[model samples]
Target chain A: MAILSLAFKSLLNRKLTFFITLFSIAISVTLLLGVQTLKTETKTSFMKSISGTDLIIGSRGASSQLLLSSVFHIGSSTNTIKYETYQDIEKLPAVEWAVPISMGDSHKGYTVIATNLSFFDHFSYANKQNLTVQSGSIDDDMFAVAIGADVAQKLDYHVGDRIIVTHGGGEIEGHDHDNIPFFVSAILSPSFTAIDQTLIISLEAMEAMHTETHDHLGALPGETLLDSDHHEHHDEHDEDHEQHAAHDKHDEHHDEHDEDHEQHTAHDKHDEHHDEHDEDHAQHAAHDKHDEHDEDHEQHAAHDKHDEHHDEHDESHEQHAAHEHEDTQDQRIARLLKLKPENINAIFVGLTSRHAVLGMQSYVNNFQGEPLTAIIPAVALQELWQFFSLAESALNIVTTFVVLVGLLGMLSIILMSLNERRREMAVLRSVGARPSHIFGLIIGEAGFVCLTGILLGVILLYAVLLILQTPLANYYGFYLDINMLTSNDLFILLTIQCSALLIALIPGALIYKYSLSDGMNIKF
Target chain B: MINLTDLSFAWNKQPIIDIKELTIKKGEHLFIEGPSGSGKSTLLSLLAGVITPQSGDISILEQPLNLLTASQKDTFRANHIGFIFQQFNLLPYLNVLDNITLPCSFSGIRKHKALSQSKNLESEAIRLLNALGLDDPELLQRSVNELSVGQQQRVAAARAMLGSPEIIIADEPTSALDSDNRESFIKVLFDECQKADITLIFVSHDTSLKTHFKHSLKLQEINQATIKEAV
Candidate 1:
């Protein structure tokens, strides 16, 4: 007790130095724990993103592929299953529910998803969790869209607001449905997923757009935009000229007549640069003239080449058009086969039996539909964890490095002060203190300093995370969900304290070694 | 009582103190004088058990000092010996009362004797301060720094005399004092030691104070040892 009092007194004499060490250690600890906490939370949020969905019965494809494309907004589908497939799959004995997703539209930068009210009612994420309503109701009308929490917050949209949607995803798309704008029906609370960045609508809305008659611009008068051929050509030439000028600006380094080379690539005006429409017109004129006999051979060769080239180009274009036709056909077939007029992308299932996974799996295997599958969220998530586990390991490495640096800084400070404290130690020894007692004093000093630092670190970290939560959710669609320390935090805190205790000993051991060697020669 | 026989001391192979035989009876006020390098401080250290001799044995109160361990030496010093260093012996942070009672706190036997003496050590400290001719009321409660050099020395003397330790070692206690203060301080110290029946081993290079001590020995004549044997 006396030793403790004296140690405190000694520290008070050097308050500035001790406090500097305390805060440095505190900062290092906070960074370490903060990195660790954020990493764990990211993995957790990813796993929780698709909770309510029990069985995702889509067109026949890899289960993994279907999940990534439908749920995560990654990759593309190989083939869309016919609506007949969904109808047949929905009739199985063990099957409780099914939802078909119609993909291929974007609004601003958000994905425009076509699904029914069942998606809002049944889809769960983060261990079969349901979505919590913040405001407004689920979407019901065609041309009515429910936006995700992140999308709504970012765009500042509320119910009754109208927004134009594009036929493809992302903010940079050129076309929009301004003539048939969608009214915002509801806004979801933040779920920290691709869902948070999606625009939810009914399949009827998708069908209605397809059925509507299109204008020469492939859109309604005020909605669609056309790409003018003449203006496009002029823009291309302007871009080429700009590039040529830029090349000329840097031509001083080029000694081999680089300016002429730039002009050739930029604007040769040769046969290779002939416009497609001009070439077609020229080929038609050549075939009509049946020119002079010698000229006839040259004209015939050019016409045959142009014809052959046009045929190849048409073939590729036809192939693309055929694929698009098949996609449209499949979408129509799937819609006609739907038991209800509503469209749902996925279904969340809760079974009284724990064998829900096996039942769902067997039901899908025997399914007479195009191709259907059931996914146990836990199993799928554990497999997905392999990818995110790298982040976890990186966090561990960073945390370990931070703790080591903190300990090193502390050790260096204590070691530096040892020479000055030698006389103080001798005085203590002269006062009937045992060697162990002296050793305890040093260890106690370190423990006191580090324990204070750890407590301070926890407080600082809590405040910082709280301050950053809203911005983090807005910028990254990750709702940090920070609160007072939970059980997991307690376990983490224990680990931190243990590390500090272990590190504090480094200086204690050094002091003990010094005292032993110096013996009576140590000044008093 | 203290005795030494065939004692040889050295400092890194150079002899410093070589004494064939010496005996100090109880209550003997011995004055030890030597030129510089005569090992007066070394002899005092050995008596105080700060260091052990290289050969032979020195006994205090019939107990062999060399046989005691380092911790035992600390205990023995706190209980049986009082030291008055040249200057600045008192802990700067402690007040006059705490500095006076420090030895008793370290050694239980001394604490018992100190508690049973004139009054609780505070009153005894007050008595010793008065006996030393320091009558200033403000000086008693003030920190050690607030006192003059002479007043501080008187406080040190009073602290050293606490619990009446059998032996008092004063190493040039008056060296830092003015001439008048020095003479008066010396008189007060000797008078107190005499009244307590304590043995005094006072070391100084000044020969003028020789008349005050009953027994006096020049360290060079009495200790014919060189630095080699004193290590």
Candidate 2:
């Protein structure tokens, strides 16, 4: 105890040099622990990006590329899967639920994902946790879009604000879907995953936004729009008209499923258009007779006529009755604008049982409708993490070298002080301190400095982590937990402390020899 | 009492100390004076058991130091001897009280002896400081570097005289003191040694200070190595 106190006082006497050495060690320790934490947390959050899903199926390509594009939003898929193929997979016996996703659109640098209500129902991440809406509820309206927490915060979007989406991943000239802007209907809570940086809308809205008829629809004459009865009637059959117009204009550019559906729909619609043209003239005459009704009442009258047409044609009476309960003008127009999806980028699949994942993966790989690839998310994440292991090891090696440099600095400081402390050692010897005591004093001083340095490093790491938490989650979707100190960290700290003690031995031995030779003789 | 017989010591094959016989009775104050490099410091090192003689045996308090192992010699030195140097006698890092009590921290016998005199080591250090004519209460806690040279020598005297060691070997302890301070410092040192009945061996290159001691010898009279170097 006395010798330790003496060592401490001696270091206190040389406060500037000692504190500089201590600060260098502390900084090195912070870098080491910081790198370690980044490596571990990144791997953990990366693996947690998508979980609880049995498999992910996409157009035949590299599984890693598919995972990166679909789950991480890092790149684009090479090809798209036919919507018919997704329907087939959804109908498989082993599949519990499957959510189809359409990508290749962006809203101000944030990816826009086109999915259905099934995505909100079935998608889970980070231990089977579901995405939650923060303020508003998800609506079935085609133009109603839900944004993630990060998207809402970054773009400053609210529930009613409308945003224009670009056709591809970037804002290319003439590719903005300005005619069909999407309004934010819901904002999702933070999931600490890629979902937190995305804009989600129904696939039907995505189909309508990309169709050429909507582009022309936005440029319709003002007189046509002012004619309320005709405009409402025109909005009622807008989906069919857009589909037929797209089929007639760009038949070869669509998928085989879309062409086949278009062919059947075009024949039915060709006859229906002629019949509906006369019926629409009759309805216009009837609406003129009821011209005493106000504009609001006139919209209700048009809805009643639309419901009558639905009863006589393809839709059921019960469906029409259900629509009448919540049929606002916007909802009515949204229903008309919704179209069936022709193709999708990928599908996230969930199974009734975990044991069936491998079997389902093989089934998806051998799918006959079109070439497809399916992968277990966990396995693919592991493979991806292995690719990062080399970088992780390189980082660790660099930090380890930094710790070495810190220890070497301490060693050099101690060695230099030894030259000036020979008289002190002789004084100690005269007062009956053994050579072993001198040796212990040096080692003890180093141990003390190193232990304090490590503690300071931990404190500094936590401070930095606390300051960067929100920015990291907002920018990179990295959620760093401050309270996580694994046994691995303890092991590394222990190794550093032991190495410090061992390194102190160099100067300890030198001073020990000096004390022996200079025995009781004040050399300086 | 201290005794040496036929002691011979060499430094890098050059004889630095060669003594035929030396003895000092209990409680005797002896002064050994010599010129610089005339083996005064070397003789003190040999007497303190810090270095072993290559040929002869040194027995202090009837224990043969040559027969003891290096570590045991250290323990024996700690228990039986106290040392004072010319200047910088106190470790600058410790306070005046801590400097005076330092020997008690290393030696169990000295600690027991100090405890027997006072309630604890601090009071015992105070008692020694008071006897050495440094009664300032604030000076006990002040850093040793804050003291004047005379006060620093007094603190060194207190440390060497604490726990009543049998021998006090002071190497040119008065060389750095002024003429009046040197006399007063020698007076207080002799008073402490007489009170404890300690045998004092004071070595110096200054011959004027030898008048203060009853028994004094010059290195040329007894050290053949220095005489031979002179011839």
Candidate 3:
């Protein structure tokens, strides 16, 4: 303790120089720890970007390539999965749900995803946090599309604004879907995932745009939009009578085993039911018209006290009944158009039970008619990281080098200051401090400076994280949580402190040697 | 009491110190005069138990210092010796009291001796400071840097005399002071050493200070290496 005080006093005697030295160590330590934290957070956000879904089914090749292209929207897929194959796998009993993703388009720099409305229901990220529409609604209209939070922020888009997706790559292509421009029906809230960088549209909407010529795309946008909007209103009418009419879209797709011939069979089954319902409804309509005067006379008495005129109310009621009969015909045709997905690039699958995941994975991998790959998301992500571990290792090497340079600065500072401290050492030596005490003095002082530096570095990193969290999340979709320290951080801090102690010993030992050898001030 | 016999030291085989015999008893004040580069500081380093003699032996208080390891010699010096430098000897960051009591922390003998004379280390330091004519209580808590050169010199002297070590070596300690402060410094030093019965070895090139000591010697008379160099 006494020798430590002496060392402390010696340092305080030269406060300005030592303070600068300490500040240098603090700055470099911040950079080193900051890099380490960024690496961990980046890896975690990447992994948590898409969760809950069990498999990503695409044509066979490198799993990393598939993961990058499918989940991260980076590069391109190895091959597209057949839409026919997708429908078959979805039919399997082990499957709970599936989202077929077909792509090769972008809005500005953001990727454009073609998926069914079920994607808004089934797609998950950041661990089961579902994609939520912040503004507007997810409609079934083919031309209506939803934009992600980051995409909307960057493109300065709002609900009802029309945008077109580029046809080929994100950029470097003049061809764009200029004819069938999409209106933003919804804008999603940020999920800190790949979804934030995507513009999502219904699979049929993408198909509809592709089917049109560039000139025709914009020409008939008004007519198609009106038709799709009318279809949406009619579908809501089924919700009012939902108990009888509500059919699960999944069951409709699941029970049918017929392939390309499925359209006729399914349409006939529905057509027969509609015919029977129309006959019953027509008979009721004729009977209601005959009794219309009598019914209005009784209803008029009931509503006469509530409103001024009875004829006005009767006229509105008759018009609504007439419209309802015509709307059902439009709905039947629109419902048939809902199942028009011809192809998809990849499918995200969730098994009926967690245990069924592995069995179904291999069955699909060695699938009978064609080669395919079914990847367990967690395991595939792990493999992808392993393949790219070289980059991570390279990053590690750079941070370590930076920390070493910082420590060396600490070492050199103490060593340079030794010249002026020689007389002080001799004075202490004269008053009973041994060469070892002098040694401990220098080492202890160095350790103190390093420990302070480490603390300052950690605090500085968190402060920067706190300040940048919102902007990064809003613009880049990187939601950095400042709380919690990973084991890697703990290990790095421990290593830095240990190295501080070890490095201090070098200068300590050198001074001890000189103190032992020479006379006053110990010329070496 | 300290004794040396046939002591010799060399720097790169060039001799710096060559003393056949030298003896100083307890409570004796001796002034040793030497010119610049006469190995005066080298002799002090040897006597302070920092470096061993190349070819001879030194004994202090009946203990054979030549046989002790460097660390043991360090312990010996910490317990028994005090040193006052020409200037800038006090550790600047420490308060005067801490500077005075520092040696006791390194040596249990000095600590117990210091503790026995007063209530604690601080009071013991105050007692020594008072005897050295620095009686101001506020002076003890202030940093040594706040003191003037002469005051700093007195604090260094007070530190060396704390716990009343058996030997006090002053290496031109008054060289940085004005003549008036130099006289007062010598007076206070002699008075404290007399009261505590401390053996004093004061080395300086100034021969005028020799009259104050009971016994004195010139480097050319006692040191064979210096005589050879002079010839």
Candidate 4:
């Protein structure tokens, strides 16, 4: 104990060198623990991003790519699964619930997901925790949109604010769907997942926007207007005018049907046009009014016949024309309900039992309608995490080297001072201090420096985490839990301390030999 | 009492100290005078048991030092002998009181003796410092660096005389002081040794100071190694 106090006093005497060594050690400790904490937390948050889902089904592709694009919003899927296949998968006995997601749209750099209300009911994250609205409940109105917490906070959106979505992902310009703007009806609570950066709407609204963009006639059945450049040809050619007049008459006749039956039949008629539009838009646009009318007649004949009220139909036609320039929320909602999605990018599936997961995966892999891939979310997440292990190991190696540099600096400094302290050792020897006392003094100083440095490093780490927690979570969706030290962390710290003592042994042994020879010599 | 029988020592296989015989009774002040490289420091080292002679026995207080191991020798020195140097006598890191009480920290026998003199080590150190003519209470807490050369020598004297060890070995402790301060320093040192009955081994090449000691000898008179070198 006396020797330890002497060592401490000696260190205090060399204040400048002592503090420099201490600061170096403290900074290195901070880096070491910082890298370790980030590695563990990043991996934990990555795994937490998608949970409670048995499998993710997407068009045949790399399972890792599908996981990245669908759950992490990292990239876009190259292919989409047919809506019919999704329907069949949803009805399987092994599947408890399935949420189909359509992507490839963005609002202000945030991805826009098109899903039904079932997404809120079935999609979960971080230990079966369902997403709850922070402000407003989810609405069933076709044009009503629910935005994630990060989207609402970053874009400063509130319930009832109108937002126009772009046709493609990311921040590409000039593809905004200005004709169909959706309003925010709900804002989801923060979940610290990719869901926090998304804007969600019903699939009907998604189909309606694309359909309106292609047809330019607001998805109305049997009323396909020629491209704007062809409008003058209608006046010049009596044949084209007569075709348009007949099509206008057909539209007026259909307006007399009940609202439900009209929307239902209109959706059936729109499906054929949507498929044709997707197959070849230029060819669909080049078709004359005669071909459009013939196709519409076939779709109507396929449905049940209803009585036509000509006067009421004509009045409704005029109202629809008048409402084209300024469509209200109710008018937009009514139009959207009449449309249906043709395909979706991915589907999240939940199973009734964990044991049934493999059978359902095989079922999705051999899906008869289209080529698809179903992957267990947990397995794919682990595979994705492996890709990051190399970078994690690299960071760990760099920080470990930094700690070694700090310890080496301490060793060099103490070794250099040993020559200057020889007279001090001689004085101690004359005063009856054993050579072993000198050895213990050196080790004790090193131990004290390391212990204090570690303490300061931990404090620095917590301070940095506290300051950056909100920004990191908001900007990067990384949630770091600042809790007490884990046993693993304690073990790492103990290892560092032991290494310091081991390094100190080098100088301690040297000084002991010097003191033995310099005994009572009193050079000065 | 201290006795050396046919002691011989060498450094790097070159003879530095060779004495046929040497003996000093208890409470005696003996001044051994020698020039540089005459093995004045080597003789002190041998007396302190820091090094062993090749062919001889050194017995202090009837205990043979050669039989003890290196560690045992260290403890024996701590319990029996005190040392003061020519300069840099006190550890710069410690204050005057801690410097004086340092040996007591290393040796339990010295600590017991010091405690028997006063209530605790601090009071005992103060008593020794007062006897050495450095009675200023503030000086006890002052850093050793702040002391003048003469005052530092006095503090060194206080530390060596603190535990009432049987032997106090000082090597040219007055060499750094002026003549008047040297005399005053030796006066206080001898007064303390006489009060405690500690045998003083004062080694220096300063012949003028030899008048203070009744038993003084030059290195050539007793050291045959120096005689052989002169021949």
For residues A245-315, could you state the per-residue lDDT of candidate 2 as single tens digits? 33223323222323344433323332344343322222222222233335326444554555457546654
- The window of 10 residues in a row where model 1 chain A has the poorest summed lDDT is A330-339
Best-to-worst DockQ order: 2, 3, 4, 1
Q: What is every candidate's C-alpha DockQ against the true complex, given to 2 decimals? A: 0.11, 0.68, 0.65, 0.63
Computed on C-alpha atoms, the DockQ of candidate 2 is 0.68
Whole-model lDDT values for every prediction: 0.66, 0.80, 0.76, 0.80
List where candidate 4 sits over 4 angstroms from the true fold.
Answer: A170-172, A212-214, A218-337, B226-231
Q: lDDT by residue for model 4 over B159-221, one digit each (tens)?
A: 887788999999999999998899999998999899999999999988999999998888767
Give the native contact fraction of candidate 2. 0.58
Full ranking by TM-score: 4, 2, 3, 1
Given candidate 4, what's the lDDT at residue A389? 84
Taken in order, the candidates have interface RMSDs of 4.4, 1.1, 1.8, 1.0
Docking class of 4: medium
| Residue A343, candidate 3: C-alpha displacement in angstroms | 1.4
- Interface DockQ of candidate 1: 0.11
Instruction: Estimate, for each residue in A166-241, the C-alpha lDDT of model 1 and write its tens digit.
Output: 8656445566655446778778887778888888887766654543324433221121122232233235454323
> Which is the winner by DockQ between candidate 1 and candidate 4?
4
Give the DockQ of candidate 4. Answer: 0.63
Is model 3 an incorrect, acceptable, medium or high docking prediction? Answer: medium
State how far residue A80 of model 3 sits from its true place (Å): 3.3
